[model samples]
Target: MQKLQTLFAPSAIAVVGATDREGAVGGAIFQNLQKNFEGKVYPVNPNRDVIFDKECYQDLASAPEVELVVIVVPAKVALQVLEEAGKVNIDNVIVISAGFSEQNDSGEMLEQQLIGIADEYDINLIGPNSLGVISTHSGMNASFGPALPQTGTISFMSQSGAFVTATIDWAIQRNIGFKDIVSLGNKAVVDETDLIKEWGDDPETDVVIGYLEGIDDGREFIDAARDVVMDTPVVLIKSGQTEAGARAAASHTGTMAGSEQAYEAGLRQAGVLRADSAEQLFDYARALAGLPSLDQNTVAVVTNAGGPGVMATDVIGESKLSLATFTEETIDAFDDCLPAGANIYNPVDIIGDAPVDRFVEAIKIALSDRNVGAVLVLGAPTAVLSYADLAEEMGALAESHDKPIMGCLMGGKEADAATKILDKHGIPNYFDPARAITGLEGLARLNTIRSREYHSFEPFDDVNSDRVEQILSDAVADGRSRLGVESMGILEAYGIPTPEGEIATSPSEAKEIAEQYENSVVMKIVSPDIVHKSDMGGVDVGVKQRDVEDAYERIVTNARRYQPDATILGVQVQQQVDLSETTELIIGTKYDSQFGQLVLAGLGGIFVEIFEDTAVRVGPVTDREAATMLSELRAYPLLRGARGRPAADEQSIIEIIQRLSQLVEDFPAIMELDINPVVARPNDAVAIDLRLTIDEGKL
Candidate 1:
């Protein structure tokens, strides 16, 4: 936090490439700084005798001591300027120059040099391709973008310079103010994690909003965000949600652990609210900033128009929040004040002809009700009512009451003045009742997150880490990047139940193994190369002892025909597990490139391929979080005994998931693991099939 203070609250600043040339980036920065910043500003330009009427220094050596420096030169010369600034002991820098990392190979190399120099000098660098930084609290506009915003509690950070500029323009038109804004272009040193921690502790900041294209360190970001959300709500909009990788996945986990899924899981686990659009980001931010955290999900709506009231009620019904059931006393009060035709139900319609006094009385009654956690007031442009009066009364009533109040002013010309009045009093007004309901829903979601207790992974005493390590070591030593049937041993070592199985090289051997099982047996072709054995007709279930010989021969023949060059290691004979009265689930793990070790679970078999319904979380997952992951699945009802079916062994499934999380945590080289179709009964669960993909490079 101290290091970040220099970047945001520097006493003195120097623009390294400052100039008086019109429309130049350096000149724009210098002019803005001179006009808005309260601190002393210096210009470093060898050619110019003066810049913006301030005497320009040839270099840092000629200039007075400054706490921060802004570099706007080319990428090639930026490093040299940083070196000079370091020599003079400048502790902070905002490299507003481009052509680094975002450009070609030469640019990437230059960025590495800048990072090296920053480390050597212990300097806090913002970016090599950044716009700049702005601090409304300190009255600083050090950026080369537009003017600074009015002082407010919401702080914003973005990766794109265009996004920052566009958001600022939109904010100004909407009268939205900010505490701080930073354009994190190619974040070389100071990234989102640093800013989150700094803003989390900033007394002036009430909420933090971010626009990110990608993150450098997923784990670090999650940890920082987790801490920040405890005090200040963090709303983020991460782009590239649909841009998943196209690699040939060897397991169900890898197929489902797309880049977007990992990010979603990570952010949810960290208690951050994800916004789907720019509007939602600010909508959620404004509500979180202006209103107190919602302690309950029940909401009451008071409206002068029945149609809009119905709309608001419908939206509330769709949201996580429920319509507040007014107490008998509150209902009686509303009936006494409102006209006879007015509906004093949950919507509490006071009629369109009702004046400002009637509206105010109804709102007061609803807000005063103990059952109401929040209230939404809706007003149409009626001739009898003055929007100005209603807006003022609503604002005051909201302030007087302890619960949050959101307004829906439902027309354009007539509601404009009322909207501004609501804004002035820190009451958010939406043009549509649905939007107001959505904002209230965001508050309820935030309350849910705040109410949850923090959970951490607890290691099981029965886990044998050494044994798991040796199993992976042997797989790598045998010149195999993937483990075949041998990986089942790894699951058993972790206490995960697997079907009884034995490898048979010939049909006679397969028949001998099948004879041991009373009911029936299953046979599958074993090969390191074939990830999906079912695709090549290599799996045969419910095989009798007499048919095992023929099934083995047919499976081996199919494998040879499918891929002639593939390595075939005979057939696996296993006792067939019945799934007629059981639930089939997939429990798997994958190592994400940015965020390591993600656990995935979902409904197994054709449902997994068709619906793609799965839930993921960063490993190692705790017992409680594992349950959460399962509940997040769209098929959760199946496990909960839907349609009068007996509930599957949910606890056992969670235990297996936790074990899989531990497996990947122990051996990161086990890049992808899939225990597809783990048959779960009412009391027990067993892994029906297993596949493990190893990446020795990670080890």
Candidate 2:
């Protein structure tokens, strides 16, 4: 945070490569700084003696004392400047030069060298290809962007420099204020986690907003984000998850829990609100920055026109917020003050001819209701009504209530004039009713995130770590990438219930194992090469003791015929439980590149792909989160006894999920794991099949 303060609020800044050259990036940066920067600026250029009436120095060593250095030179020269800064003991630098890791291999190497220099000098470096920084408090506009934003609590950051400049311009048009702005280009050293932590704890920052392309460290990001969200809401637009980490997975968990899923789970667990669009990013940020938290999540609409009122109602119906049911007392109050033709309901239509006073009366009555959590005022320019007057009333009404109030001043010229009045009191006014409700939804969503209980992952001491380690080690030593039912001991070692199963080397051994079962048994070909035993005709269910040898021979023959070169690693004879009394489910884990192990739970069996109903969370998942995951699944109703059926052992399933989360967290080498057809009975849950893939290199 201290380092961030230095980067944002440095007293003296030297612009390396600054010049009077037209359209040059360095000149633009210096011009921007000259606009409002309260601190002294030193312009550096080898060819020119003076730039913009200020004397220019040849390099950092020649420049007078400067607290921070902004490098805008070419890639190689930027490295030389950085080395010079290190030698001069300048510990704060923002490299606005491009051609870093985002470029070619040589550029990546250059970025690494920059990091090396910064480390040697104990420098707090921002970026190798960044757009520079801005602080409204310091009156600095160091970035080569458009006009400085008006002072406000919402501070913005973006990985794309173009996005920063464009958003700053757009934010001005939309009347959005920014306290500080950052363009995190290349993000070699200072990344999203650093910005979030710095701004989240700052007293001036009401809400932390950012546009992040990637999170460098997942665990560190989650921890940093979690630390601040309890006090300040963090909204981000993470835009690079499309088709990321999408591979031909060996298990359902691996195939479904892609990089996008990992990011979703990570962000959700960290309690950070994710905005899918640019409009949504500001919509949430504005609401968090300006309005009070929407606690009840039920909204009442007050409008002059019925159509726009209906639109607000529709948006409220679709949002997490509900259409507020006004109390009878509030309805009666509206009736007394409104015109005869006015409809005094939840969306109390005060008639098209309603005056500004009538509109105020309707909204005031709505706010007075105990049932109404929030209020949305919609108005179309009418002959008798004054939108500006109503805007003033809306501002006053906003101050009177503790609840959030959104206004839909629906018009062009009239609404345009009224918006300025609403802005003063922090009342968000939109041209459309839907946008107003959407903004209200953001407040509700933020409240939900803050209200949620965050739990810690308590390690289950009952788990046998030693046994699990040996199982994974043996598999890795064998050079086996995939483990079949033969490695069920891994599940058993984690205290997850698996059926009585053991590898049978011969037909006699298979018969002996089947005879021990009360009835018939399940025989499956045990080969690391055969992933789907059923598809290869390598499995036979209900194999009686008498016919166990024949079934084993047929299974082995089928597997050998399917893949003649495949390793014939004997067979697995397992006890068969009644499928009719239990529900089949699939639970699996996949190590995501960004967020590590992602534990997945949902409908099992071969139809998992068809259903595609699953819940995912980054490990290690706590008991509450595991239960929440199960409840999130579409098949959760079935587990909860939806159709007069006895409830499955959901508690047992949660326990198994926690154990699996621990297993994956304990050994990240277990890259992908699938426990399909894990039977869930009324009292107990049993694992039916196991498929695991371990990364030998990670082990």
Candidate 3:
């Protein structure tokens, strides 16, 4: 990796296409550099004699002793300027030209040409279409935009130039200072992962935040984030987590947005807090920056009203976080500050009429409690209390306390005062209690994920690669990706407990297989073209051995009638496993063009997509991670013996997930695989049905 310092450092720099005219990108670039930069700046323009009181050169070849070159010329001219700059050993270049790789075919061709030239000279190019870069610590403002206010511990990276400037303005409003800001337009040479890796290690940057439309190398980005996020938190506002969002992002930055599931999985594995919006990006980053390490997720809410506290609890229900269950000892301690009938539970509501001292005492007691991981103080002005004084006291107590303190200020004018006071003290606060809970919960969540060290799964070198390859080749040769039931069975043999079954190529074979099984069985039409068997009425269930002779004939008849166009592949006959008391689980893997293979888990059957009740983790999920993923799901309660039912063996489920994760991580050509209705009984789990799809050249 080329040192990031070389990219930002330049004793003498040249700005190509610098002009005398006002409001031009080149002119703004030159002027901003002149205003903020402590080093010498030279402007390059054939027509202009001088720019911003600095002598202008006609080209980079004529510029005196320049190290870094900023190219803000037209697309055609920028290419020529870079070539000239390269000749002069100017290895660091920032191309602010827009037409390359962002407009049309010609632009893409031009971008490739520029990259080839830079590669030949071993030069580092920031972007062919970018707003350039900014560094507050270096006092360098080479970007063509309004100067950013330098104040907090964050480094911002954006794919959009407009968004870069907008984020800078937003940061100013929130009193957040940036250590460095880079706009990666087109990503002609450098990319976001490179920035994440660099910024994550920078001492000046305590937290790294990105406004990303798409990643250049999804796996690399994730690994880089995972490597450094434990030390310096990373928050990303990824723009493409939905089909509509993907389309919008693709159009916005010209980067292909891959599967939303894959993106979500990658972010979670990397421990990146994926924010939904730009505001949440900074909001979450600000909160994470100041948080101290904590041992638990027990939060103490000090709200003036009960409604906000209840809402906070509901929101917190998503994570492992819980409101602190106040012990009788702690309850007795809090009695000194509360009125007779005030609710003294976890919320610790001081009622609407409590004074500043009452709120302070409540907070002190909560903080002193060993069980409480964090404290959330909610302020709603009443006739009795001064919110400013309460906020100040809360801030003071937080400075001395071991745990993090967040504020949720309600009401009108009182909320404004609370925000100002907290903002001044560099304390994280929000208008909604849910946001506060989310912030506090992050502290505990971070600690939990960090405590569990992730060990990468060993490669499956012993698996039957030859057999798997032969099946994959056959599927691809037929111009089909979906595997037949027999092929799916072959795939599942590589994993855990597959059902005892046999494929019947003919009605006679079906009868023989049916005779072998004593109990009722399931028979499904197996066709490579049939992606959804039940949807096409190709499945026949509950055929007893006593009725096999007639049932086999009816199964064949229905299979052909339902899909007359589809080839009459064989029927698969298997014993009908009892599902009355077992938990239905689905494990699936899909290849994403951006993020690579992603492993997904959820409650199974038809309602999976409808309920959208699922969780994803990147490929090769460790056994512990798989357990955590299951435990994190909203439906996990059902799996864990809900309503007096016997709880499923969670370790068995975790083992199955580990195998599935390894399969996906090893076989990149497998575009998709699904094991649906994995029946988890009290002691074990079994896969009832399976599907696998392998795409050619996908590996």
Candidate 4:
């Protein structure tokens, strides 16, 4: 990652279309840079003598030692300027020119030509239609935008120049500082992932942020963002999540936006901090940057009102954070400094009338407790003592005790004073307890994920590559890319377990197998054409000895009626195991345009689409990560025995997912796999239905 600052900064900069004409983009850009930038400026205009107190040059050849050039000229002339800039070894160019790529094919061709020229000289480019890039640390302002704030630690990268300028203005108003901001219009060459990777390692940048229209390479974005996440915190405000947004994103950045479900799964797998809105992106970035890595998700709340404490509890619970129950020792310490009627449990009610010392003692007790990883102090202003003094003492205790502390003050003017005092001490404080708790939840969730990752799983090597190749090859020969139950069953025997079933060519064989297995069994008409057995009524469950004879006929008749064009391959008879728990899980591969085969895992069944509960780990997820993913599901409580029923063997599900992940990782030809209704019987689980898709082109 060459230093990103160079792309926007130069000792001597050239503005190719700089003019004296009022309200022109070129004129605005020249004025903005002249106002804020401290670097040498050269305004390039064929007709003008001078602009912004700098001598105007006729072309790139006339600008002496131009290190970075901003092009606001027409698209046709922009290409020529890039070509000339390349010849002169001007290695950094910011194209504010709009007629490339965002307009039509003609513009796209022009943008490509500019890229080719830059590539010939190994020069870096920012955009063909951009507000340009800015670096506050270097005093470089190439964007034709308002002045940006210089306080917080954030970096914003976007595919739209308009959003970049709007975000800069918003940040400036809120006193939010930026390290680096880039507008990657069209993304013809430079992409979101490229900048994320570069910004993550940039010394001036603390928290990397983005406003993404769409990812050009979904897989590359995942890989690069995952690598960056290992070091810097990344928050993305992904805009193209809906159907309408997807179409707009494709037109805006020339990217085929993926399904919303898949995009979210990928984000979770990469462990990137996700935000639904730009405000959240900024808030989360601000809060997370100052917070320490929490040891646990348990938080203690000390509030002057019960209402606020209840609200905080609700938020914490909703976010999967726990409210700590103070130990007997902790309660005794709090009682010593409080009135007799004060509540001393997890959410301690210090009462509204409590003075500064009382609030301080309660906070001290909460922070000192062994079980508490963090404390939320909710103080209302009191006339008897100074709120600022109380806030100072709380901050002092937080610093000395080595525990994260946050506050929510209730009174209007006094609360602001107290909150500012906490901020001055570098404590992460919010005006509302619920918001503070939400931030705490962020800390808690991250800690849980980190804890789960500590125990890694070993890789398994039980896959039969030769069998996979043969099955995939045969499927492709017949214009079919998906494998039937029989083929999937064969693959399953090699560590991927399927139901105890046997394929039979004749009714006699089906009956014999049914009798051999149990009094109760299932008879399913098998055919490569019918992937979903239940959809075709090809499955007959609870087959007794007498019913086996009839159930076989019923399945065969149903198969022929449902799929008239297909041949009845046979029936599969298997024992019907009592499934105490009914849950579905899917493990499959999608041929991503950029990333090749990517594995996916999620809750299955018809409700799977409704619940949309899923998580991804790149192919070959460790067993530990699989288990954590399963546990992380929103509906995990149901699998953990929500009622009186015994819990499913959670470890078994993780093992299956891990094995399938390894299979997909080893065999690129296996395009998709579905394990619906993996019946869990307290101690064991079995894949009752299976289907596979293969891609011969990949093989």
Candidate 5:
């Protein structure tokens, strides 16, 4: 906080490369500072003796020492200026120059050099290619953008310079104010996590909004966001929702973690509200900033027209919120206030020609209901009542109630005037009922997040870490990064149930193993190089004792033909368990480059391959989170005994997921682990096949 205080609220500032040329970036920044900033501003440029009718110093040596410096020179000259500023004891900088990491190879080199210089001198740098920073509370507009916004509680941070300029323009036109604004260009030094922490402690900020192209460290960002959301809401709009967008994000921000699924899972885990578009970002922010946090998900609607009231009710039903049921006492109150023939249900329609007193009475009755968590008032244009009078009454009622109250005055000219009245009283007004309902939905989501409990992963003492370590160590020693059928011992060490199996080097050994089992047996080729054993024809199921030797030979032949260079150890012979009555499920874990370990589960076999129905959560997942992950999957109904089939062993599946999460948390080198076709019956679950991929680099 101390470091950032100087960057955002410095006592004095110096603008290197300052100019008076019209339409120039440096000139624009200087002009903005001169107009709004309530501090000393020094213009440093060797070419100019005077800038903006103020004395301009030729260099840093001639200028007075300042706490912050804005560098708008070329990349080559910015480095020299940084060294000079360091000598003059300037510890804060915002480099507005382009041609940094955002450019080609030479620019990347220059950025690295800038990082090294900042580290050596203990300087806090904002950007080498940035749009700059602004603080409305301090009357500081240090950017090369437009004028400062109106003072308000929302603070915005963006990774794109153009987005910052556009959002500022948009906010000004909409009368949306901000406490602070930042453009995190390149993010070489100050990243999103830093700003989250800073603004989380800032008393002036009621909400923190962000536009992120990519995240550098997923776990760190999640932790930071989690802490901030505990005190203030954090609304974010993340790009890269598609594969093409992911690729573009990587190229744009130089970030490696471009997986949109990972970002979504991580943000949800951190309790951050994600907006699909720029407008929704502020839409959520405004509601969060203006209204009290909703404690429940039920909303009550009061309307003058039935159509808009029904529309609001439908949208609420579609959202995660439910319409509130009116209590008997509340129903009696509404019936007494409203005229005859008025509908007194969840929508609480008071008829079209209702007067101001009738509208006020309906809202007051709805707000007084204990079952109603929030209130939505919808009004259509009517000749009997004025929209402004109803808006004023609703705004006063909103201010008096602790619950969130939103309004939808469905019209243009008169509604616009009414909206301004509501806005002045800090009551969010929407033009449509759906928009008002969506805003209430945002409040409900925040309530859920606030009430959620985050549990830590507790290590089970029964896990045999030594046994699992030996298996991974031996595989690495043999120059094999992947563990094949022989690695079932690792699963057994973690207490995950697996079918009894034995490695047979020859056909005689395979037949001998099959003779031990009364029912049919299964044979699979054991090799490190083959990932998808079925694709290579390396598996044979339902092999009787008479055909065991042939099955073993055929599996080996098929594997060798598919990959001649693969080192096939032997055939894995095991008792074939009937899965016709059981659910085929897949449980796996992979180390994501950004978010560390992630656990995935879904229906196995062709359903998993074609439908791609899976649920993901970051490790080390709690028991509750594991169950929640399963419930999120589209195939969860199948596991819950759909179609009169007995329910699969849900507890067993959750325990396996918990154990897998623990395994990955303990041994990060176990990069990718898959257990496909885990036959789950009524009371038991067992893994039929296991594959483990280890990254020796981590080891």
Candidate 6:
């Protein structure tokens, strides 16, 4: 962060390949830098000695000592200019040149050379192909983008240069300001994590927002962002989401989980708020940067129009935010101040003909309520009301009150003057009442992010790591990347209870194992090539002790029929669990390519994929996180004893989730695992069936 502060806050800047030529990238960058850069700006171009009437040096060597160098030459020449910048003892450089890693093979080779040079020089490089960086506080406009953003608390970074330019244009019109901006294109050196950490320590930045296509190191990003988000709210609009395509995934967990789900969980675990669109990105940012943190999740709507007020009410009710139920004293106060024909309720509508003073009085009353955490001022344009004056009064109320406020002065251009006025008092004005509710929602979300109590991995003394390691080694030696019920030893080693089971090579052995179980036994054909035993009629549930031999013989015959060449590893004679009062649940882990291992918990059984009611989180989950994961499921009600049913042993299931996470994290060889139909009874949870896949290469 200290390095970044120095790199970004340079006293002198050199724009290499600066030219007077029309339609050139260097000329655009040089001209933009001259417009805002307060420090000495040297233009380095060997072909020309003059650029935009400023004297240009022939090369970086000829130029005076500079703190930062902006490279805007071709991909080939950009490498040479980088070497020159390094040789000149410049510690920070921004390469705005294209065709590096984002281009072909030769371009990638050039980028590698550039990385080597930066490493040797210990330089802080911004980009090999980027729009560049901007520091408004330092009055530095190092990017090619034209718009110079207003000076404010929000700092932003984006993967796309075009996004930064467009957002700047939007911010200027919307009056949203940024402290620092960076276009992190082909981030070879400085990435989003660096900027997040830098902004976290910077007092100037109030909120950190970014337009991310992908993260460089997903795990590292999570850890870094989690540390900073509590102090400075981090908002992001992640564009691309990935899925496991054409990969041979052996478990139900791997098939259902994707990089998109990983991002969803990873970002949440990191205490970062994800935005679905660009509108949401700044909508969250503006609110976080300007408004006070919401003390509660409830909101009170004070409006002149009935319809818009209801719209605000609807959004508040639907979102995590609730409609504030004003206290009796506050309601009586509203009745005293508001005129007749007004709906003196939570959405305290003073009628459409009401003026700014009536609206002000209503808002004052709403904010006075202890129940109200925030207020939404939605006023439609009326001849009787003055948006400008109303905005001034609201701003005054905002200054006096501790509760946050957002407005919906719903009109084009008519509300512009009021928007700025409200903005001055840390109150954001929105055109849409629904959008106004979201602004308040952002404040509420920040409170949650700040107040979150993060939990670390819990230490379990009962688990046996050596036993699990031995099981994995056996699989590797056998050249088997996947296992069925035969792999239940892994669960037992981790102290996760499974139905008493033993593999039988012959019908007599199967019968003997079945006789041990008092009620009945389940015969499942064990084969490396066969996954879904029931589909091939290789599974027989509730087999009597006398029928165990016939059941075992029939299961093996079905397995051979399904796949003739499959190695029949024999049958697993397991105790049959009574599913009468138990809930069929699934607990599994999918090794995501980007965010590492992800643990999932939800409705189990065969329909797990169809229902898709699951919650995922990064591996090494703690007790609290495991419980939180289960609570996220829509079927959470069932586990909690919904619909006149005995509640399942949810705590026991949570233990299984944590133990599985520990096992998976302990051994990277275990790629994907599924403990389906984890029979959850009133007092105990047991693994009924499991299918685990391994990465032979990892083993």
Each model's number of backbone clashes?
A: 0, 0, 2, 1, 0, 0
Candidate maximizing lDDT: 1
Superposed model 3: Cα runs more than 4 Å off: 8-10, 244-258, 301-366, 380-398, 407-424, 429-435, 459-462, 477-480, 492-495, 516-521, 545-553, 575-581, 606-612, 633-652, 682-684
Writing each residue's lDDT as its tens digit, candidate 1 over 1-699 gives: 235877788899999999999899999998888887888999998888888778999999999989989999989889999999889888999999999989999899999999999988888899979999999877888898877777889999999999999988888877788999999999998898889999999988999999999888889888888888989999999999986457778876787887888999888987899999998898898888887667789998888888888888888888899999989999899888888899988988888898998888888899889999998888888889999999999888877877999988888877878877888877888888877887888899888888888777887779787887787777788888877775688898899999999999998888888888898898988898887788889999888877888899899999999999988888999988887879889888888887899999989864567777888998899999989988988889999999999999999999999988887887788888888888989999999888889888866
Question: Which is the winner by lDDT between candidate 1 and candidate 5?
Answer: 1
Q: Which whole-number lDDT from 0 to 100 does residue 372 have in model 3?
A: 88
TM-score of each: 0.97, 0.97, 0.87, 0.83, 0.93, 0.96
Residue 170 lDDT (model 3): 68
Give the Å shift of residue 594 in candidate 1. Answer: 1.9
What is candidate 6's CA lDDT for residue 23?
Answer: 87
Whichever of 1 and 6 has more lDDT, that candidate is: 1
Q: List the residue pairs that clash in candidate 6.
A: none
Runs off by more than 4 Å, candidate 5: 1-3, 245-258, 560-567, 578-581
Residue pairs clashing in model 4 are 152-177
lDDT at 365, model 5: 88
- Candidate lDDT scores, in order, read 0.87, 0.86, 0.77, 0.73, 0.86, 0.87
Residue 245's lDDT within candidate 4 is 43
- Residue-wise C-alpha lDDT for candidate 4, range 326-408, written one tens digit per residue: 88999888778778778888789987788878888888888888899888887656577587888899878867877778777
Q: How does residue 477 of candidate 6 score in lDDT? A: 92
- Residue 241's lDDT within candidate 2 is 66
lDDT of 2 by residue, 1-699 (tens): 236787777789999989899999899999989888889999998998999899889888898988889989998998889889989988788898989888899999999998888788888788878888888888888878877887888888898888888888898887888888988888877788888888887899998888988788888899888889888889989887688445577877778888888889999988889999988888888878889888798998888889888877787788888988877798778878887988888788888888988888787788888888888888899789898888888888888889888878888989888988888888888887777877888888777888788788998888888998888888778777789898898898889999897889899999888888898899999887777778889989988889999988899999989999888789899998888757789999998777888999999977888898999998889999999999898888899898888899999999999999899999998999999978999999998999999888888
Error of 6 at 201 (Å): 1.0
